[model samples]
Target: MNDKRASHGFRLTLAMLACVGAATLAGCNGGGDAHAQGRKGGEATAWGLPYFNMPDIVPPNVRQDAYTPLTDAQAGPPIDPIKGYRTEDLGGGVYMVGDGIYNTMFVVSDAGVILVDAPPSMGEKTLNAIQQVAPGSKIVALIYSHAHIDHIGFAAGVVKAFPGIPIYAHEETRKALAQANDPNRPVPTNTFNTLDVDFPVVVGNQKLVLRYPGPNHDPGNIGIYHPGQKVLMLVDVVYPGWMMWRRLGLATNIPGYFGLVKSMNARWDFDKLIAGHFQPGTKADVETQLEFMTDMHNALTEAISTIPYSDGRLNAADTKNSWAATRDWTDRLTNHCVNKVTPKWSTRLASFDVWIYEQCMALEQSIRIDGPSLR
Candidate 1:
């Protein structure tokens, strides 16, 4: 018994020594000469892969002093610091109100004002804007561009201001609000289910046409257009001068998003576009966004087909770990796609450096799943 116990202890000691030796060689805790330390103190595990030059815009997981500055065109008219919002006239009775970040529209009619989207960011300021332009004009109706909290979270405030005012939304928006059951966003009083035809809401002299182009940014996100003013308002889809919010504005359906942007101009004949963010846009802005989307799609598709799954970058020991291997493959693929578009796009779109990697990753995954079938 003593001999057997001694032999077991000796083997355990040898095993521990082997582990310590391996760790020392690998620089302890999977780091060392085998890792690249970022400027911000984050370390990227070495994959023995060719170095991918990061875009001037900071990549994720790294702290930076500041982001790329916005171009002059990207910056819109300044907002009043005290009021915390800005209002722009869209001609005729239609006017746009925004905090320079979140925007909504209101149309003043002979009967009353028709308020479109009450983003919580602008909250009471939305009502104040309506009052500023058309004093004593009761907000007769409220329209939700979509069911997103950022866009319509302040609907209840509007309803409170004008008791029993009809709230209009697509059936999907109503359903979503009903599910949420939040007091901030009241369920629509009137809901439209038509997908093909335009749903027009005429209040006194003002008329706003609502059209649902299927699901893009979110389900039931409809286009609100004023034919007389030649203005179109669509929420959370186009970013005007900026690169889209991360993962294509956190789109639930990427293919649908691509389709909507591609066909937006052809479908709506509008001089000014109220895209629910930043400054109002023009047909030229839509065209620029479409070009960016197309480049992203084309670049991702090419990377998906040409970049090998293994690519000789991943460590041999990690081969059996499917998740690790997949992660490495995707990182390489995203980097390749980012590098392809950085030259032209980095200078063109605002925050192009900020969300480009995420955009590439999103598109690459979409092409793999919701694909044109990888060639």
Candidate 2:
């Protein structure tokens, strides 16, 4: 394995030099000029390598929003200080509340209401959204999408607003929260320990299907389904329009993350997906993500197999500097994947250029070290 990996790294280094010769030049003053030229045409030439043969596939309905310079809609309605969060009705008593990023779901029923994942960013705004839409409705249940502090960090707020409300989460989430002691995210009131279980939250006329689709984003993150509304709320797993967060949502299990996407694509019969971030996503959005991930994976695998050495800094006899050499090799491998994958993906996905390399680096580490292990 070591010999093969070294050969793979050598090939990758050669490819990097061929693709971005000026940037890879050991000490060239004209590196900046070379980089600029590379941007103009080097990007195209670099992507022509055999590893990146995946067709430039993207969904017809993919979002083309700019990464910076927030448009009026992206900036969110004139920031009313008094009205905390913006609420978008997803119909059938389901709604999404957030300030562009960090979103959660809520459903109103005759009995009361069900709220999912209250991040500290939303804070009291989540309650405001609930009240704005369902006036006089009591929050009866709080669902923890996972044990992540960023997603459910405002548990104290929820408990304060609706005392004694039953909280639902997978058993692993309960355990993780119990161990962490984060004041923002409290332990759940109820927990389930199964990989896949159908636990229904029935209040009055509303019913939500709480499912554990085997730990993808976190140990116990779940997919909340509103059968009547035909909407699925899977937190931190999929970004609606923009690129998936750094490290593919910082997944604990990379393969598990991919599996979760496939599982939802094959099984869910919903129209809209409340993918836990950005704007509301659709089936097409989900499909686009799958395509992006698969393309990156294929490109990374090919580069790893074809490279001649791990890092360009070390030769066959550099046994004394092995650790330093390994570190440098990782960066070279990461950059090669980045240069190769960005061109095709940048045109199709929003902010693809911004986060593509970060995602590539994360995947490179996982693939090289973890070797396709789900965990």
Candidate 3:
């Protein structure tokens, strides 16, 4: 019995060391702690030993079948270096203007031009994009999809240039902007609370609908639908060809986010989807993400059920007194979920292996603590 206990202790120590090394090597500089549960609050360690010196986390071996191929859209024409942005018409006067990484929309109307979400990355390039598509047409309005500075911060610049153009956002967004007090992201001149679900802004033949599809990304994130163009614009919710941004795009409400994805897919009649991140997508792409998320949900459910809350090999006193047990359980559960889903999703979604652990951790927390509740 003594020899058996010693052997178990040694193996447990090695496993802990491996995890510490992986976390250290992986660089814990990610957005937030696992589940935003306020960090482990000590020297972040693996098995009570300092983990900073450990080697990086080893990714699971990529199966030949799990490789994600770049679609034609992703490999589409490079942004013109000279122009600094590319403007592609999506028919009916709606245009997708990308300054390489981020894309926004602009609709040409008889009265003037309407711009949606002027990302700071686009900078002066946004003005140049508008010039290429609708020359001499003044921007009469600016639509903010959400209060995220990355997406709507440049609206301040646009407002300065086009003065008096109405800035539109959901009531939740207006409140968020006021609290954030960011100079770059000015509060909206027009705000809509729960009373207004569908707010339409008509610019000649161009009709843009601003909607609060319940809080998914942030409190006031709104969706922009251009019915005339058969295009629906929402940001940070779905990635067309890639795995979702880390932590399900850092969603505040996980179930709400999932619900939004399902509701949006069924509710809209548009052919083209402007997810406001990666490549704009088709109905098929939206369905692809939905399928991937469903698979993740199922995988997490299984991991939660089969994985023991505490590994028997762990030191009982250490497990009870320290972060060891929680850490051990999370490591085991995360790997289990990763093994189950990565085989199929890695091949279908870009960067699946890169961010899958964080994705699983976030979902596991939501399932356990959030109690399957939707607010």
Candidate 4:
């Protein structure tokens, strides 16, 4: 037999011996339940072997019995069931509308209304909110944050409501929408390039400075800033009090995501942040999220450096298969990273347990493949 086959056979024999020995011990001890014993003993596995305290919420394999409860801060204000959506006036004529889950914004001016994003979840309620707040004003322009379907799915409805209304977005967004060929999100009528300088979209009496800070959550996801209102609307990048959606809000570029968050926190002169989810955020929320992200980065960096590839967890036969070996190594690294962060962050961020594993897995891969640059 070949060396690999021999090694596999030897390891299988050892595993069988270990199992027999374990059974012998149980039988000698009046056939005690190993799983029950494991629970009574500190840091024990199901078979009564000592192990780390694994998190209750593991993903892709382990289904959580119940997710961590949301704190009052994370829940934000309740939406009115009758109206199906709630609108918040953020000073000036800018108002935010959401169905307690998805959010979008609009700026009303003497000339007309400049609406930003049209989440399908909000649907026609977006128009209702605009009518309730702006009253009699026409929607002259619709600005898309990016080409994501969830954020701009209701653009079709907006177009139907106001025909021939000019739609504006970054040049990249237009390209993506055109490629998507999604009728729900008609290609922007007007597109601005965000190469070196910030693009300003002036409609009616309102003006929004659209700056594409490279790719973060998605390519061409621009920051919609209202200088007059001191409100900055950047969607899918920051999650305020809650944990970010899976894979860092499914960011296309991990390094860019990090850099954008740091840049926005440092450069943007805004009091309120409309992060396109839940309620608007403040500088404190941004700082808190930054701190959490930094912790995750540091923990993952240490884990990658300390954890060995040959951790003895993989079967001997699997070593010949590179894909299997890599999967085992990454799983071990991710679990270590998850355990390190859970202690401090579990209660700090809402739904932290829900997506922490995915976040760790994403960062680990980025660190290995994309180079470690959490600017």
Candidate 5:
């Protein structure tokens, strides 16, 4: 039964494809009200792909063209860190770090500095970004929110910097890392096991809480919470206050993803969110994520409710075409999101979100039902 593949692939953006971006798009310092839509004012289309018309509330400097597959950068199009990694000091030497897509929250505690996911791509400049905050504190702990490469790719950098620092991850996560690290495997550079920590062993730290969000983004995915700062570091499972100029909705398997969101929400919560990517967010993002999940849930419920497609229409879920609920969720995008950026971006968000979701769906179908434990 594990061979369930959706009828078609939905579009996605490079920004919305991972645990960090869509997962953490909810909470921002600005008014935290979940908008019914974004502020994109215009609409455009290209490549026979219908461009989504949006409201007039786009973010700054977003490219409006649909991001077709780029063969150049493996990480999609590269974002400028210097201009974007605008670190905000929350006093006490603690910093909520990121440029919008990949933000890390660093806690300079009495013991040492704890980093929630290193910069996805780190060189001397990335390391320098952290050092500027605390000149000589060892990266005492490296906590990964999920096994996705964007969240853990910089582990090598952190390892090079801290050497034997206590790297933490879900037990399952460590196993995924080993597989990803083997050169023989495809996508060997996946930052699957960058930080190795046992969730049961350190679930409740006096300073921070570590959690295992099973089978949500990945089976080994875990979340790190800093109770003191009210910073919840989890991604992919939930996204908050996301700008849709990217039209990022990479839901691979609707039925399965619905189950995942419910399971993770059963895990943890926080006041301030350090998502895998995008702005530091709030509880509202979790709720928005729930909405998406609920919608998908209902979609599946309707699709499965009716067995024969020729039978009278059952619901969004009843027909074998029930998977359309996944794209239906995206089509309901707030127009303001796509139009919020520069002109000619009607396809940008839809192109990215739709495609990424397709890839995830395709991958989900390829895996075995009783799949190997990432651990």
Candidate 6:
């Protein structure tokens, strides 16, 4: 990795050059010119990468309405992001629980209410969200889509908030949590202890909530849908293009994503989608995500099966310019400027990422048959 301080790559260099190349060259001679330079400098401060492949890949987050990224003058794991919370009214005692950058939600009643994603930092915040949403109402159940830290980051929080609040997680989730607290924890808290709640599976006006796992983001990953309300909630399974959500281009599990889409499309009975992060979403986005997943899978499968590599390095002619190039050169470490930017997610997701990358390298080999493209 580059040893330069702050944002790495020439993108920042481009930004700085655009900021005052003219004024600096004009010399620091006069006050008026210097004042003009000041104005130019002020205009230079803007968020986001100045140069990315797609400007519209994800919607840009506005300052006032989105999670503001904190700058790190130092380097470590990618923990620059700190999640905060807010709520969006979704009518009928329902809401979109927003963590500034991502979104979570709840539906409440006197008996109990269902929650999407655990509150961050144990129950201090989850309990706080509960109190804010339906003060005094019991959190009858908690649902986790996957084991990503941001998704169930506060499972402990829920446990603390409501004590034995019945939490419903995918079967695999049960395993992850059961061993989450080991002293020699593997890959952080990838596993955890769920509330051991039983739930009913239903679709389309069916009151029964269901659990299904196909591709395995975290063994316990599944989607939550309310038949009557047509509310479908998923976490890492889908992320919206927004300021808070990171681009999954090179970070996601393409093959696992494909299986995930296939699984979701084959089953489930809802129309609205409340993804874990980015802008509020719809079922169409899920479908689109499916398509992308499939594309990635097909691309990777071909590469892996056909590409020829030796000594652990792919043959140059077979993978001239493709995802293989990136994977081959990916930094062995994802040192964040702060804490590990990624949360203590299920080992399943990690497994998926690994699978996807291996296949991606294969896909790179497949594309090599066509010769290198402008990477």
Clashes of 4: 0
lDDT, candidates in the order shown = 0.81, 0.73, 0.74, 0.81, 0.46, 0.46
In angstroms, how far off is 268's CA in candidate 6?
2.1
Better candidate by TM-score, 2 or 5:
2
TM-score versus the correct structure, for each prediction = 0.86, 0.79, 0.81, 0.86, 0.55, 0.53
Per-residue lDDT tens digits for candidate 4, residues 1-375, read 999767655554443334334543542122234434444443233223321223334455333457889978789888888999988999899888888778888999888999999998888999999989867878999999999999999999999999999898999999999999998999998888856367888876789988888878899999899999899999999998899989889999999998887778766789999999888998888888888888889988897898778655455777899997887778767877887788799999999988998998998899899998574
| lDDT score at residue 65, model 6, on the 0-100 scale | 26
Candidate 2 lDDT at 2 equals: 100
Better of 1 and 5 by lDDT: 1
**Relative to the unseen true structure, what is the C-alpha lDDT of residue 197 in candidate 6, on a scale of 0 to 100?**
35
lDDT of 3 by residue, 1-375 (tens): 698766655654554444444453333312233212112433322234322222233333312223345666655568788987888789999988876568889899899999999899888799888887778779998888888888887888998899889888888888888999998988888877863267888888789988887868777777789987789998888888888889899999888788888778776678888887766788888788888888777877787898777655455577665577787776677766676786677667877757887887788888888755332
RMSD of each: 9.4, 9.3, 9.3, 8.0, 14.0, 13.8
lDDT of 5 by residue, 1-375 (tens): 232222121112222232123332331111222121122211111111221232222222332344444233223334564554557676555577665556677777556677766655443444566677877766677676655676667776777767666666665666776667732111222233323332431222336667663454566566776655656676665555442212123433333344555544444545676666666667766666555434323333333343222322124343456565433333222222222222433232223333333322222332323231121
Model 2 clashing-pair count: 14
What is the per-residue lDDT of model 2 for residues 117-213, given as tens digits with 9 covering 90 to 100?
9888888888988888878888999998888878888888899888899999889999998899877787898887876768888888889988888
- Candidate 1 per-residue lDDT, tens place, 26-90, comes to 33223333333221122222113223333333446544456679977788888899988898998
**Cα distance off (Å), candidate 1, residue 85:** 1.5
Candidate 3 achieves a global lDDT of 0.74
**Residue pair clashes in candidate 3:** 25-56, 66-347
Q: Write the per-residue lDDT of candidate 6 for residues 1-375, one digit (tens) a residue.
A: 656533443444443444324423432222344344434655323332121111111112211122223333111123223434556676656677665445677777546777767635433555666677777766666666665665667666565656665556665665665667522111222223333232563212224364554444455666666656667676666644321123332223434444565556446666566766544666666665555444544444443444333223344564766665554433111111001211221121222222333333433433344332212
Off by over 4 Å in 5: 1-84, 90-93, 122-126, 182-206, 243-260, 263-266, 303-375
Query: CA shift at 17, candidate 3, in angstroms?
Result: 14
- How many clashes in each structure? 0, 14, 2, 0, 57, 17
